[model samples]
Target: MSRFAPNRYRGKLIIVEGIDGSGKSTQLSLLSQWLRSQRLAVSFSEWNSSDMVKGTTRRGKKKQMFTPTTFSLIHATDFADRHERYILPMLKAGAVVCADRYAYTAFARDVARGVSRAWVRNLYSMAIKPNLAFYFRVPLDVALDRILGGRAALKYYEAGMDLDLSQNIVESFRIFQSRILEEYEAMSGEMGFHVIDATQSIETQQQQMRQIVMDRIGAALENDILRSPLEIDRAG
Candidate 1:
């Protein structure tokens, strides 16, 4: 068996993933706030952090240049950069890291966009897998409406496809969602995934997420509180 590294602090890496407008941002904020209240050494990061891909995706209303392949590649680069610079370091520091989106989005959306599953997975080979990933399940239409509610006209990649293509996309999302749902269900048994009732009100979801984070970081929060400036200095 591969034993845990004692000098390396293995903080729980938690990720929340789902289709656009699945309320991932809201849930991430709530969970981070709850962790702070409990005094846990937590760090927050996002995939599209004001980066090119996010800007490109947001520009969907102006012009659509991103195909499924382009979208997948952008996310792949985004995560690889994020993992190397932010995620891995914090995880090694024993600080809980919460990510708003992760590789699951690439897997789900790329498959929905007709990209081969193997190709998409290969692009993300550098990403450090999260210990726990929570997927918020919602219908495509619900997600679409929520996303489109913010604006009008398709941007670079957000072009609403033609009827036949649109149907295909929705169907793809359904197929992709179903596969991910099954994977998450199986992972639940192994403590890698925790499925939340996303259909519930946002408040309820926040509460549940807070409880989960608290459960994971209980000891860490206490340790931080006990470690005064002098104690930390001595340890350093």
Candidate 2:
């Protein structure tokens, strides 16, 4: 399948991408709240959260049954389910859809796990191109510290133990994430990602994100009014 062009849907799609602990999720949540505060219809979608495949993915992870190929396929299934059910419908309804992660996650992680980059991109060719895609770039060590500081132990796949990168989970995580980071850097230009320095204060990052988003989509959203039934009836 060829790459799908940006949709002509009434809504806008905004997505964030980064390694785990890069605080992309937090920034996305803030952006969503700001959009809603502005009276725009907003919806949120998260990566790998599709109920259709969540249980299966959990079991696969528990049993450590996924190779690089199987891992890629499973995530693709999750994305497809969300795209059709949650993302597409909300977009068609003129909602600002905020995604915590998108195809870029698979592109970086799957390739880091030894899956072919071309195949991974082809798997997600049907995805709608986002109006704004933010890539939160943080140093690997900083990301590691943030995640580990909040957790007791890293999960098997989360730390990239499957690839035998290191005996120690922490070391393996560093190595694996570094590979993913390299892929993200290479893709930043190719994918037209607006890269943000994530080590700044949270307030600073959020301020920058808000300014960028407003600059990009403010004109389109400014006049988008959601009328109540009474208002609609009066107009009619």
- Structural similarity to truth (TM-score) of each candidate: 0.70, 0.93
Best by lDDT: 2
Q: Each candidate's root-mean-square deviation in Å?
A: 6.3, 3.5
Q: Which number leads on TM-score?
A: 2
**Stretches of candidate 1 exceeding 4 Å from the true structure:** 1-8, 50-63, 150-156, 159-192, 220-236
lDDT of 2 at 37: 76
Residue by residue across 1-236, what tens digits does model 1's lDDT show?
11212223456677897666678888988877776665667788887663645666666424655566776777787777777778778877767788987776666566656788678777876666665577787665676667667756443233324212435554543445455454444434443557777777999988887776568655555663222132355655
Worst 10 residues of 1 by lDDT: 1-10
Q: Residue by residue across 31-136, what tens digits does model 2's lDDT show?
A: 8888877767888999999999999999999999899999999999999999999999988888888999999999999999999989999999999999899999
Against the true structure, candidate 1 reaches a TM-score of: 0.70
Clashes of each: 10, 0
RMSD of 2: 3.5
